[model samples]
Target: MSGLSTTWFGVIRSTIDGNVALSDINLGDPDGNEIVHDTIGKNLICTNMFPAPQIGDADDGIPDPSYPFSTVGRNVIGQCGFVLAP
Candidate 1:
């Protein structure tokens, strides 16, 4: 399927799990580049998925001053206003 539009303005299920799936998401197709997502028209597309975990706690006397995140270097937001040039 070289020219098949299996991902044309539609949501695709990229992954799944048994009994532990975290709500299957619909992340449309990739634009010119088959890696970046296209959310230009999808009004429900959110920019930030989760806020960077803070290191301080309100009850703690001293702040931890350190943020330990497992997925800090990954881009989660879908690309908006992206157009495939013809």
Candidate 2:
């Protein structure tokens, strides 16, 4: 696993198994407003995703355990972003 970052209340843990390679990934909210967590994985390949969100707007570089919107699994990410949603 490589290239992982968070904005505000962001906490992440990566566990590598078998053979895997990850790059430029920011699992949960771009600003890390949510608790983005990752578990065991095997034979995986990822890149160019999970960028930090703009300053302010709830994610003020603070860790808020009460913030919702956690969990970044069971999804197909190929460039589209959650921040770009309506």
Candidate 3:
């Protein structure tokens, strides 16, 4: 028997208020293995993968002001500039 292996790579950019402007971004990867330089922000290498957090209404049917929930937290696999590999 033989084992199989595969690899994947990509880049991610994020902002605090989801107001990041694309015009300020300029990214290019001279080498396929990694990014050479980026003007937008720091470049992070892919490390791990996990399911994003889930959001739902409160048990009492009332929104909690202290712990409000939003769609922004959903579907977000990682922090800003996070990368994932398969």
Candidate 4:
């Protein structure tokens, strides 16, 4: 994912259900690609798959206070975004 327009977002409002394994999503992959603007929403349980963000938790896969989010710390959106401890 390279040469994206300024108006486009890298990721937004995505959901991950049971049994799906994900990690390091768009973590400077494809040689030299870094998702600068992304808002991802996930519905996952427990451990194993985690978005290992290197540009700080708030700036990477995790949510932060930006154009998409109104405030800081709150990354996940929607009711399903909340994960219950299993």
Give the C-alpha miss distance for residue 32 in model 3, angstroms: 32
- On lDDT, the leading prediction is 2
**Which numbered prediction scores highest in TM-score against the true structure?**
2
- For residue 48, give model 4's deviation from the true position in Å: 10
All candidates' TM-scores? 0.14, 0.23, 0.17, 0.21
lDDT tens digits, residue span 37-79, model 4: 3333332211221232123233445555452431113333222
Residues 1-86 of candidate 3 have per-residue lDDT tens digits of 01212232222222233321211122232221221112223322222221211121221345445533322322332232322211
What candidate 3 gets wrong by more than 4 Å, as runs, is 1-15, 19-49, 55-63, 71-86
lDDT of each: 0.23, 0.39, 0.24, 0.28
- Cα lDDT of model 1 by residue, 35-84, tens digit: 12122231322232122111113213342224211121223333321212
Question: 62, model 1: CA deviation in Å?
Answer: 7.5
Please state the error at residue 70 of candidate 3 in Å. Answer: 2.5
**Winner of 3 and 4 under TM-score:** 4
**Clash counts for all predictions:** 0, 1, 0, 0
RMSD per prediction, one decimal?
16.8, 12.1, 16.0, 10.4
Q: Indicate whether candidate 1 or candidate 2 has the larger TM-score.
A: 2
Descending-TM-score candidate ranking: 2, 4, 3, 1
